[model samples]
Target: MRFSQILRFHLSNNKWTAKQQYVPKHNPVLEEDIKRLQDFLMSKSNIVVLTGAGISTESGIPDYRSEGVGLYARTNHKPIQHMEFVRFANVRQRYWARNFVGWPSFSATEPNHTHHAVARFEREGRIQSVVTQNVDRLHTKAGSKNVIELHGSGYVVKCLSCEYRIDRHEFQDILNSLNPEFRDAPDMIRPDGDVEIPADYVANFRIPPCPECNGHLKPEIVFFGDNVPKSRVEQIAKMIYNSDGLLVLGSSLLVFSGYRMVLQTKDLNLPVAIVNIGETRADHLADLKLSAKCGDVLPKLFNFKK
Candidate 1:
């Protein structure tokens, strides 16, 4: 089936029922607010968009912090703090194992309407740049030309000891050699990919060493407690600085890395618009809030002339 047909089917069949169910209730935006957002975008020669997991949820990826479906809530796991992963070998192994299993699902997800809308905005010259908290790379897949990944992507694995970088596929081979029994593990496995192997069995699991320097390997994403790379932060800041306004999609901005952009935009006195299903940490900071599904609202709001 064509992609459009698949989207229509999913929308009609209620594949995203959970998301719809959790949609927050907020006062409907007045027509004046809509006009303000529209005028802001129209007036700007350069607009910057900061997006979160909400944008990808329509594509079947779950947001990490959305009520009962959040990663920590659903997995019955605590958030992995950065210090723990860096200091503890077992923690690192567990992290990689979970990722190994979850990688396929994350990798398989495609761009949805919101992503396409952002791409359209860029193509139409309404948007000059995008900064995304999602590591899923949906924006790039949707043909966005310039995107800053605030949290690094899961598509690449880097060795800590030797500083070696390898494609996720190559890392999968290493995982296979170490845990052959888990090579075809079921999808029900943990979100990070580690199977429910007994603690005794875990001892025998041989995490592969870096091909270059025999060092530890880690996913490129910034885990809880890890700081965003300064250079990456600066790049996004510069993008925001140059743009006339900022648009936030699908994020609550609970994390400072995500929230700080709103503060920066406000500091620069730029108009800010947000499209989210729930109350975001930056809600008070926005000039306009569209309390609607990104999939439903973005396509309409950013309809570009082709």
Candidate 2:
């Protein structure tokens, strides 16, 4: 099956089923569980939400870390680490080339139901803050006020040498001017906003430099090997410390940075509830684990007046 078809299939059918009596498959939010979660939220003055790539997958953004759906998987290559991309000039060229090709579709993506639901929760004061591992700025676009992007966003690319920032659109224009022959080239676009191109062609592609400083430009994100900024980490820690409880959405919590936050919530004796599809690393830590689609559960759960 094609990538788009596979995505549609997962979206249409993915859900959770109940094994116990008096429980429903489509409705993973049991009345008892809802009461527990609702009471938890009501008692708390502040509630924190930790989100991941899964939250944005519904908006047609792909999870670049997953087995079959990620950029590395599509190319049958190991993921390019942060250090490698930064150190190797050819790697940087390929990286930018892919970014140039896939920029349009990624830039065009809009926020989905889950994003809107979370944003609404924040707006209504149901959620105090959101810490996300995703690079997509859908949370902010959906109207969320206090969002901490653990990984950087795709919309902004920065120069490695001069630290100059350029919008993705502006960088695309530069790529077009430099490589006119590749303007109409066809390639498979990956979920992480990267394109699959021929290795030889990628090796020869010319990447643009910072117009003012002649520095190397790169996507502003926490690459695979890069650590999340300490200041951002401290900020999230403070948010978690201040919040009554932590609510996790659509994340597996596979990475240590996110998982550590969930662990901290548990250590603080705060309730941690999770809404996700598969088994997460923090499943054991979750006070209530709702194994269901976020789009289905979040709206009802965070709809304060209801």
Candidate 3:
């Protein structure tokens, strides 16, 4: 079927229900398909790998719209809008309060097999670079060098007013001092280091200001309704143009920023491969599609020790 003939690529409600009951039943891939991807990678020089949250799910981080397992499936709440976060003090407070509590556990998360596999590939000179949509920085932790963080990282705090940046781990100490009696009321953690704490719990929550100018502090990550910087986009496009092939791992390409890479590669007539459990926006454009968990499948495909 043509790209135009494909259905709009998002998870369906019936599929969500089935996933909840059965859990993680990815479509079985043909042996020839794996061989095709392996051969494709071996033939390419300066291969570019793009990744999304599915690569980090095995590391204990929940994805946003991943059928039954995602945060959107579990909750009716919408993600905090960029305008709301910048404009409203109360919104930021609620966000910070929940995020600060969630940060401890979320930060403790380590790189899984999926991350290691990518890193191993890079080390073996099979891949030139990786571009990730995730804020978790697991790719870096797994020892993948030359990674372009498409959405930036959540590990740093940025002052919206003064342009001051500080490590998120350091900012956590400040948060602890501000809300000593405040503990996380909800056990559920969201994809963006936020939790579902009670409204009452957030009412008196304190969001610390920037030390230099007493400005608002936000996680350095790009929020929904926010635009990725033009410079970053240009840089990523150049990298994609320079690459011989594009390999997408564990991303549905639901967001345009990550999806654009595949589109660019297609436009350039470069070979494209996508490894995702669910339907991706660029599925029709890919030369190969592997519907499997990145952690398990990637290790099987690319063993660095060999």
Report the C-alpha displacement of residue 297, candidate 1, in angstroms. 0.7
List pairs with backbone clashes in candidate 3: none
| C-alpha TM-score for every candidate | 0.84, 0.83, 0.87
lDDT of 3 by residue, 101-181 (tens): 778776877887778888888988989899999999899998998999999898999998997999999999888888877
TM-score result, candidate 3: 0.87
Backbone clash count, each prediction separately: 8, 0, 0
Off by over 4 Å in 3: 1-23, 183-194, 304-306
Best by lDDT: 3
Model 2 earns a TM-score of: 0.83
lDDT of 2 by residue, 42-92 (tens): 676589999987777667665655446544464555655899988889888
Q: Who is ahead in lDDT, 1 or 2? A: 1
lDDT (Cα, tens digit) per residue for candidate 1, span 1-306: 754355445545874573343333445555555565677688787888989888776676666677666555556666678889889988877777666666765687678777988898888888898899998889999999988889998888887776689888777877878787665444335422223545644555668777788777788889888889999989888888887888998898988998999899999999888988778898888888877667666666644422
Whole-model lDDT, candidate 3?
Answer: 0.80
